[model samples]
Target: MSVANSVSEISPRPSIEGIVEITRADMDRVNALILSMAGSNVELIPQIAEHLISSGGKRLRPMLTLASARAFDYSGEGHVKLAASVEFLHTATLLHDDVVDESALRRGRTTARMIWGNQASVLVGDYLLGQAFKMMVEVGSMRALAILSNASAVIAEGEVWQLSAAKKMSTEESDYMAVIEAKTAALFAAAAEVGPVIAEAGEPAIAAMRRYGMALGLAFQLVDDVLDYGGSADALGKNVGDDFREGKITLPVILAHRHADAAEQQFWREAMEGGSNDDEALARAMELMARHGALDETKHRARAFGAQALEALDALADTPVRSALADVVDFCIDRIN
Candidate 1:
């Protein structure tokens, strides 16, 4: 269905607040562990880490880890450590990503790279990775350790792939999907899968959590990509047209290019492929996307993935945790609305 149709069909549902409430008790513990683990005697390490961590971004990933454990009735201390590890891993990536993207703003504030410079950002990111692994080992689950470690490697590989593909308008939709799945979804899948593994749940439950996380991550990434072009800077916590300025080929660009006529294709080639980004240029590029329904179609794709995420939960028993998880899917997709 078209995104317009999908938007209208979706009933307003509970927001991420409900999920946070469900996981509140556990997440408080996770938050404490995150702060404790992020500490360092180096002073600069904690300084840089806290600069980003204190930002008002919702701790969605760690919450997912907590909620996943709760879903399986896993009442162990291991999930707490694992959840903090998940946050550190996520923070490390964001630090590196800002440097890679040369971003000035994140969560409506100056990025660490912008204030502390790229060298400090990169070093602190390494520090966070070290801490993340240390926490992982503390958990003492080889399976969980292996899952997150592999995800770390895959995330790096995805960043490299996207760097190579940057500004190449010829990039296909399949290629874009591959990049996101590796870079964004891999960690998410690991975060959810480790919960069930720690819980010693059966393979089916573990596999179901993995699938749910993967689909949710895909939906999340797609929505972020859509928002880069269409959302307000206030809403995005970063500048709009960032992908266009960076010449990053996202799904919106892919679908638009696929259907553009000769003249419109040439526009994309010059504006996006050539990285021509000014205010007027951004406006025109947005006009092209709207003219061709690229943004709408991207949102539709995200909603479809959100549906897949909800469907994956069917393998698990019904509970408030499950219901909250399902609502989280709706909340992710609702960002566009």
Candidate 2:
């Protein structure tokens, strides 16, 4: 059956405590390695890197690696390096994203780009990617290295693809999905898949982890897009309408645009092109979204992906790791509840 079509319902409110507690020991080592790898004599490199790395974000990508590996009873050290590499890849993307978005805050703190400058932020991000590749090479798994490296390329394409789609009313739902899958889900898939490969888990388990990660990534992005329109500044670590102001065509905006009539379409085009960017425009956007059921439909799709993520776990042994992975899905989607 199709994944989304097979989804039934979302689980209850979830907590990160399970995953964090389960992976505590491994995560400690991963954190140390991340810090060590981020070090550079340039002074500004480590300074900017540490500021964001320690900015209290969940570090969810690397945790996915740890959990997937531990679930398979991996006993070696490669998972640690792989986990840290996953984190480095994610952090590099964030630094680049902040620079591209001209963002002022991340996790409610001044962004690295804002604290240093776009030039510094971009360079430090490149430095992190270099560090990420170094960690992957140290792991000595060509398969894992290929997977993560491919994801790096794919994420770059996703960013460019999003720019192409930006501010264009012609953007489609498929275009938005493609962007999220490449930009967000690809890393999640890679982060999760590398764990099983390092553990030497069979093809079935490895494929299942990749599927799980991809679904989870899509779910995370969907919920994130919903938050852009409806969540609080404290919740988002930035303004609620940041996506709208940036002219990004997220799922909510895509759905709202897809369903609009002649005049409604004109309003959407105007707002998307930066002609309308005030509170009144934002309120009107919200009103149109509500009228078109855009937010509700977006949440529905997020729940479906969350369900797929939880379902993908059935391939693995039932244990704390599996339970925690399930909870992570809940953590991603239940916040919108």
Candidate 3:
């Protein structure tokens, strides 16, 4: 079925309103810090940075940090700094990712790289990374520093690993999982962990938040992969078929290729190698994925991870913030429904 038909058929989607309402106060401080740190003496830096930062996408990663802290009932300003640092880490990644992916659109607008050039985008990303570290240091927690700093390294390594695997048919499901866990979930895990760490919560609480963030990150990414094929630009905040157009192998590509016949396999090979990417080829790619049940299977995998996320939260006491965090999982998965 088409994206419109799919949307009409599914149940109503979950929203992040619960978390949003609760985290709004902390997020205000986080947003202000982000804007202030994003500015620089170099005129071009803030120009490109603000453009990417102000894009329509939800700043979910940092919000998770604030929510995690609030759930622990921590009353300190350190969580605010850590939360801003998490946003910087995340924003930096997007700046670098758009360059690496050669993406034209992000959050429904032209990418910074598209407007400013790759060099500027990469430098601004580096600047943001510096700011992220600065804020992490200001928090004055060695453990939080270690978590976010280590996550930054892992994310870089994951990017290189993904580049190496791009368009290579040998890339397996397990390999794809590793990439997402590092590139996507590492920051999520770090963002959540640092919150409870700042709260000086027990080891068990910290571990639970880390686990929840990892699962949510994985599920969120899987849904994004599915959205690249089965959703629209308007809904997705990025161009549809971008993964296909860029030859980045995601879960849908892996599943479809796994079960593909010889001709179908050949199609993927050529398409992934940048040989086929017209409108017709994109339609063909979607048709093949639909025929092979890759999209649905991907969604199933996402829901499984979402279940894990909720399970992780069970370790924490039942609170409004915890419940709101659980709702975030449903919201992430239900995006393309």
Candidate 4:
């Protein structure tokens, strides 16, 4: 049965904690599964992967996988493999991302590149990608393989696109959205949708889960952008003006640029495209964003996506698992970092 049909037959109001509670056991099992999959294979690669994996970040992606599976009453062991594969893919991407961005910190600690050096980090990332594909093959599900592989491809494309487009004033909202979706939303959609695929969920349920993932992922990225503009360094695990220093044009900057007067626009254009990383120029850009209410507007959009994510969960029946998914959507918006 479709999740929409199931939900229509249940009570309209359900508690968020209740839904998630039903999946607690499943979540734990998946966590163990992921640890086993990532456990010490060789000395250096495992050490590097563990350095960042053990850092204090919520395992939200794998949690989504497990929860989505339980929401549909999936009882097969393949979900465990799928969940582990998702975490491996995510961690692998993070390793490469730190290198590409030359970031020194993540989750408030030294990044993989800083700890292991760039070459080690890159190779370990490639190792994790290999592990991810190997796990997918073990799962032996063509649908799951297709979803994850496509997501991996999209992530690579997004990274390349971002590298080429950063600091370019010609970037539009459409272009930014495309980049964020490919980089961030693609994996989220895969994580959320894979559960139903394992369970052989009906087409409508699959579609609903896909929408839920997309909206949730977009909300997550939007909030990340907002935090870049407004969050404290301690809260965000990086300098407050890092994006501006790097000349990355996130949503707040896009809005601020659009709202700026001729002189203000010129200032942004020069700071972004001129390869200037001066502190004063970054401060001026931030000031412009605040003066125009661009930051606040971006926050509103993030909240809207969060709300849409919850609405998509309405397709799921009045189950404890569904409510948990809703809570997660809410949590994404309120995340401090």
Q: Where does model 2 exceed 4 Å of error?
A: 1-12
Give the Cα lDDT of each candidate: 0.90, 0.92, 0.91, 0.83
lDDT of 3 by residue, 125-230 (tens): 9999999999889989999999999999999999999999998877999999999999999998898888899898889999999999999999989988998998
Model 4 scores a C-alpha lDDT of: 0.83
Which candidate, 1 or 4, has the higher lDDT? 1
RMSD of each: 4.1, 5.7, 3.9, 6.9
Q: Give the alpha carbon lDDT tens digit for every residue of 90-197 in model 4.
A: 999999988888888787788978877999998888888888888888988899899999999999999999888898878998899899999999999999999888
lDDT of 2: 0.92
Model 1: weakest 10-residue lDDT segment is 270-279
Tens digit of lDDT per residue, candidate 1, span 83-106?
Answer: 899999999999999999999999
Looking at model 4, report the run of 10 residues with the lowest lDDT sum.
Answer: 11-20
Scored against the true structure, residue 270 in model 1 reaches a CA lDDT of: 88
Q: Candidate 2 on 200-268: residue-level lDDT in tens?
A: 999999999999999999999999899988998887778889888888889998899888999999999
Shift of residue 58 alpha carbon in model 4, Å? 0.4
Per-model TM values vs. the true structure: 0.95, 0.95, 0.95, 0.90
lDDT of 3 at 115: 96
Clashes of each: 0, 0, 0, 2
